[model samples]
Target chain A: MAQVINKRIILKNYVNGFPKESDMLLNASATIRLNLPEASNAVLVKNLYLSCDPYMQFRMRESKAGSFTPGSPIQGFGVAKVLDSRHSNFKKGDFVWGLTGWEEYSVINTVGFLFKIEHTDVPLSYYTGILGMQGITAYAGFNVICAPKKGEYVFVSAAAGAVGQLVGQFAKLSGCYVVGSAGSKEKVDMLKNKCGFDEAFNYKEEQDLDAALKRYFPNGIDIFFDNVGGKMLEAVLLNMRFSGRITACGMISQYNLEQEEGVRNLYQIIVKGVQIQGLIANNYLHMFPKYMEMIIPLIKQGKICYMEDIAEGLESAPAALVGLFSGRNVGKQVVAVARE
Target chain B: MAQVINKRIILKNYVNGFPKESDMLLNASATIRLNLPEASNAVLVKNLYLSCDPYMQFRMRESKAGSFTPGSPIQGFGVAKVLDSRHSNFKKGDFVWGLTGWEEYSVINTVGFLFKIEHTDVPLSYYTGILGMQGITAYAGFNVICAPKKGEYVFVSAAAGAVGQLVGQFAKLSGCYVVGSAGSKEKVDMLKNKCGFDEAFNYKEEQDLDAALKRYFPNGIDIFFDNVGGKMLEAVLLNMRFSGRITACGMISQYNLEQEEGVRNLYQIIVKGVQIQGLIANNYLHMFPKYMEMIIPLIKQGKICYMEDIAEGLESAPAALVGLFSGRNVGKQVVAVARE
Candidate 1:
């Protein structure tokens, strides 16, 4: 066997407030053999790309869901090439995207959230977002929960975020009049221009979200795909028509706070007959095969598009993640650790 | 044709605050003919029982959903016997339940929210409640929206209100461990004895609702059918477990206030994966037939229960409605204008 090498980023401490660089630590871990042991259901693989998601911050905290152990390496989604495998579903040369450690190499136990990339005609990096967990979140939330109908009024918050952008596009494709909100002027323009939202607004510039939403949706929102919940959510609640639906995917605004913002108008939910649902993408992995069928064709046909902000090496991973909170990353923040 | 009679109650003016006796004026005006023109699709009926709901107060004020015309008799749910009809659905002696004038007799348009009373074996007053909108509201909100499961911790606020009492019983029948909160000691006792809540509390005595809820639900709430919103709903949001669902049927606490109370811990909806849905009974009319099928058996078997705070005469309707704001009424507050 050749000399083994592994470089991993471990969660240094359980984060108390908003995560900081001090919350994580980079360490050189003992390497594993590039060959799998007999009868072991493990895949020895070289990670080609890793995804940086906001939900990862939750794993850094010591909560009910599996947390990153104080001294263990952080885990996330990644695209990798199998160097050796003992699982029947995968071969040594197979390109896969699943749960892998944040390192140069990984020995993935065949347990949870693993998928082999079947159709590789498109960019393999697409698996990180538009064809993966994030993609299914938009599809399931929009199609199943929201049930967006033709000519319905749809609003998407965090319109420039990975999931929001796709949700807007999908709503538009479904014949909805879609609008979105973002934190940046550039994102607003990008949403209206490239993402094809009927209208887009920079939340930073709007003094009142209710007025902002009203200006865009004159008839009021029938569906709201919420990502940055807080005042935006309160305002959306006020403007929902009779029988509106809100898909609560993430609340990036309150994740790191010692205290979060209060919603002043939830009574409007009762008065307006609204349905707000919370969803976790991990719970939606079973829809992957159907999701690929819908999204892949959309990407190939250029009916749907996603912009990715690709960082070049392992060192840039921290900045990419932290940048999400600061509105620094333009689109999906992904790290390209190595080229296949 | 027999001499027409129309005993009516008209709003004296739009109530600026909680309704009072001075806000309404009752008149035993000349009643109208029961027979509609043969060419018309209208049903002329003699009003037997009228429903008094909190939402009717909104119709008293001017807004988007237009207020009832000032001099016209107040409109509400009623059980009536069709004296004459041009409508295909109604004929002489047919008992029906629908939106009719809040008086002795009414000429109802055939278009919306009218149903033939198929089963009259039980007390006809039940159609004003368990067989009517009140029962349907509880059935759709708790069973369908909240999706309560056996052994799930279910909490209901305003648990002695018209809809809430039934929702609590529905949760109990579902094998859920149900807890209900009422404003008075009498109501707390009634919630346990009459409504069959697994546990009951007087929210008026509890200094901290979150703590009270925690004491009742140590494992945390798996479902909350929120009838009283504002601060109590906020507390419920904080205590919800992962995948918990809240079906919001009303927010009585905030209804009459000039400014609604704000919710302080809404961020928990995303973190705990709780779903808060606001529902209107009107949209679920398609399920009404099925709703009756489930409710009738429950009522017949003594597996379900309800309560009513009946005002003796139409002159007392205004006082009963205003009493809802102050938690004066036990169970549903309905007025009996006439016996037949």
Candidate 2:
């Protein structure tokens, strides 16, 4: 085994709009020894699941402060097994999830971000979606952003994706009439049956989104977790209840559009007296432990269903990422960069 | 004077698209009883000066729930002397300003709306702006919506208008380096001199708005009070700091346009972590007295300069309102419907 072997996934070039497989390349050499000195104050971990998010598309671009450095392996949230540690807080054989490098072996200098996984009895892969950033995002956005009432009409877009699926379920448990929009019929069914959404729609077949929203939510949307912005958001604006709240967590639909789609019916926000705000999971990290406490029981009782589309081995990482933009993955798109 | 007179103004077939003076007809000989029963809780007042705003243009068109009913005299904020009072809250010789109908005399049923003027030491016209909806709006939206911190970059669109002018001054007093956009160089001058804006620009002359904002706010925008929300909004979106707040009080530029102008950079909101919120001043009615306490002193000390373009007579009301679309008014556009 080589002492300094690097398994890297480099961004091919600056992505303009929608990213393709051509934008990423996996460069690997061999295995490496995992060791850290007492003074190192660092942890050596074996990478497990690497999250493939649409926001990564932003990192792949060339900018003064792009999310990640181009021509380098993109690093993001992932689950890992600690191989060796000199940090007082971490120990060998401990499982963790945080900002791990997108490689087989990583030397994490900061342990402040990493959190030890206590409930390993559940699916370890759940850290990639339901038990991780996605879950926290959905929770904080729903509870904090909207202060959703029990009988509120909840609508989630990109409803089959990592965050959307959980939001729909949370809304259901809170007694909301939940409706979600997905790209495929299969995803829509998963939302209705598995995610416990009251109603689901395949937005692709929706002739007019305003009319579709009206038919699904005859009254109006009270809590809108806006994952996809553009025409859908414009339509949702028209269908919002008085004093409605729109939590803009992400806008996957508009992420790659060269020209932003125009929202014609935004004036409704004025008359409807709606409040729209954006949310980031990072800012709400203080609520993570409480989130797990709240979510673990739901998972054990099968009240909150978790989903993932896992690609095996580091070699499949590039294809797995590109598949996200094309909606090739069924649920939480992830790659097993390494096996413990 | 003919009884049952029609000093009323007609909506004139919804004005089709942009409003014109011809769209409204004001007939005289309209009169109503100067008194109501004590239990009626209504007050009869002679309208002295009515505030003409662009938002009233929205009420001109037939809308869902008949927001601005057609064939009705345009209604807005006004300074009125109480001729007779049936409500304990009001008395004869007292002045008030709230939602007064645009006519010579109004029998306002002070059931839920209407606030009596407690101070007449300042201009009675101040009831239409500095002490009325305009002032409270400026307070809540800028103070609460933007939640601005000292030294942060603030950008105000339509900065010479009723609300924007006050917001800019408040931001400056809060130690923010404020930059405001108006339609003319004269209006721009008013912002720098009267409003104490750090920088001002006539957006119409700027070939590149993004560049203009960058030049004025080199550090990037922390707060944006968006009164004109079309191209200026898109430009501000590009220049926003992370966690920036935008208070969307009005979008006068896009209000009357047959088609809403397309925003090509809304996705920047997600990337920059900006929050754009629509605000209705009435939601913060509980904070109105607090608003008066804060602003009355500023007005008395002459530290804050308020601007108004007064159009004489009720007959000129229609033109004064239509003038807003073309930026014809130099300051807060208003019409003196009558004089005591």
- Against the native chain B, what TM-score does each candidate's chain B reach? 0.96, 0.94
Worst 10 contiguous positions by lDDT, candidate 2 chain A: A29-38
- Which stretches of model 2 miss by more than 4 angstroms? A1-14, A22-28, A37-39, A66-72, A110-112, A337-339, B1-13, B31-41, B66-72, B109-111
Cα error, residue B167 of model 1, in Å, equals: 2.1
- Candidate 2 chain B, poorest ten consecutive residues by summed lDDT: B1-10
Best by DockQ: 1
User: Every model's DockQ, to 2 decimals?
Assistant: 0.66, 0.54
Q: After superposition, how far is residue A300 of candidate 2 from its true place, in Å?
A: 2.4
Each candidate: what lDDT?
Answer: 0.84, 0.84
Clashing pairs in 2: none
Those runs of model 1 whose alpha carbons end farther than 4 Å from true positions after fitting are: A2-5, A28-41, A86-88, B1-7, B28-45, B81-94, B107-116, B297-303
Interface RMSD of 1: 1.4
